[model samples]
Target: MDNQKPSSGGTFKKFIIALVAIVILALGITGVVYYLRWFGPNVTDKQEYLYIHSEAGFNDVYQTIREQGIVKDTTTFLWAAHNMNYVGRVKPGKYRLKEGMSNRKLINMLASGAQEPVDLKFRGLRLKTQFAGYISKQIEPDSVAIISLLDSAKFVEQYGFTTENVYTMFMPNTYQMYWNTTSEQFFKRMYKEYENFWTPARKQLAAAINLTPIQVSILASVVDAEALHDDEMPTIAGLYLNRLKRGIKMEADPTVIFATGDFTIKRVLNKYLSTPSPYNTYRNTGLPPGPIMMPSVNAVKAVLNYKQHNYIYMCAKEDFSGYHNFATNVAEHMANAHRFQQALNERGIKK
Candidate 1:
């Protein structure tokens, strides 16, 4: 009986040991499966990148980044990002990354901010038009809101602009800005760009010509409207400069057309020329209060470095090519005008 009892006790100890081994082995298998599924070969350890425009939602951003293979697991990435308090830090813009970037690194990049270049060309754009384009493509600010902000007199005091006109301040060029940049920041950056463009030499030239930078910009906008070819800009600018010096009304048909804000190439009727606007050069003398459109740098430079000439009048030649006939006297201008009119009549165009 004593031997049997000792044997029974050893058998019971063996059974307990076997049961503990089974449990430990099961746990190890479970741990291996979990690790394989969550952190194994499929896990992306490299960086990844994606681009998002302004006003893009966060979920859209997540999906984009995931599709770009920036994040290995969407759920895990989101969880980590959220846990690390990066929910608000992910700005809307082009983001660069590689697979396997740590969540911390991603978060830091997001927090550091991303900048994108916005090419706002001054290619014959008025202030309202430029602002409209800027709001549409880049900042997504409300048009009415931006206009109201521009119209507010306080902006002048805040920005140190002498003119009430907001369009006079923006220089047309390719500008770089953060994707999440505010409208205020955009305007501030534009002001800085304007300051940079208006260097001491440019200011001196503008003053020497008895024109403000804004006035030069306004004249450049007119030159941009009138001159079909870039090469003709300096000569055309000289014609207008002489006319201005002589205190003659520019009588530019382009200004009349620009006053209506219609770009049709049809003949300018007397009614169209009579359209009442401050921008109408036929109706008003000298430069308009501001630019009709954003002028190119070359056009602005053409106005600043205008050629010296006694020419006071210009008309498109009868050839209908892009060249113009410049005249110092009324008789020559009338002859050229008659020839152009004759050509227009032959083409069945009524002017």
Candidate 2:
């Protein structure tokens, strides 16, 4: 009877051990299945995919990824990413995803920080327009917020520009930038691009012309506004340079129009001349402190490599086809200006 009792106790202990082993084996298999679903060969199937926006944070990223049917279980995906230290590694940008991506592969891709390039166009933009466009495309910040920030004197004072013209800082070009890039970073990158274009040789040429780089750009902006044809730029630049050397007031109509901030070309009445604005070349001489608009590289180059000439004044030819009449003296300029007025009358443009 004693032997039978001992045998029964041993059988009970063995049964308990077997049950625990079975439970552990079952759990191991389940864990393997879960792991394989997310990070195994099953991930290559094209039917299961996700598109992730680069700007999404970890939680948002996981949610978007799951919504696209890339991951069957959010908890498992989050767990895997966390365990692999990929939470901080995920790049902000558009990313193609597949199901069954291995934790290692996903983490590696995130760590690589791949970004989608967004084209930022700065062509023919005024400062306000450029700021609005940049904020809309890159950071999605409020236009008012950006304008207010740009308007702050303390913020823009470091650039060494006399005028608070933010538009002048940017060069008109299509730049590749990340979508979620900060405004400060965007400006920094643009400044870097500007520096790249303004090489030492260009700087020497600007110095030879007795103008700072910013001043050159400012003059270029004026030249850009005045000249309609590329071939006419050198002559226009030469004429302006001559006037500057002679300390003559640059009575440019464009300056008067810009000062008025009105697109209409109605007569530059005496009242318009009194308009208080820094852009008024007629009122405030010497490059108007800063650029009125972002000038193209060609315009800047034209100013730097201006042709030498004694031409002091120029007037748009009556044809308004962008050709100008160059004059070496005030009398000659007045005659050309009369011809321009006649042309304007013929076209019924009362300017």
Listed in order, each prediction's TM-score against the native is: 0.76, 0.72
Which digits, one per residue and each the tens of the lDDT, describe model 1 over residues 1-351? 545445788999999999999999999999986554444433264543356656666677777767767666667667666766777766666565555556556666665664444554443465574565556565446566566667777875577553435676777676666555666777788888888999999999999989988888878888887888999999999999998988999888887877887877468877887889987888888887767777788888999999998999898989988789999999999999999988999999974
Residue-level lDDT tens digits of model 2 in 76-119: 65777887777876666544455556755665665576544667
Which residue ranges in model 2 land beyond 4 Å of their true spot? 1-56, 62-90, 94-112, 139-149, 162-166, 266-271
Q: Give the TM-score of candidate 1.
A: 0.76
lDDT of 1 at 287: 80
Model 1 regions lying over 4 Å from their true place: 1-73, 87-108, 111-122, 140-142, 160-164, 348-351
lDDT of each: 0.75, 0.73
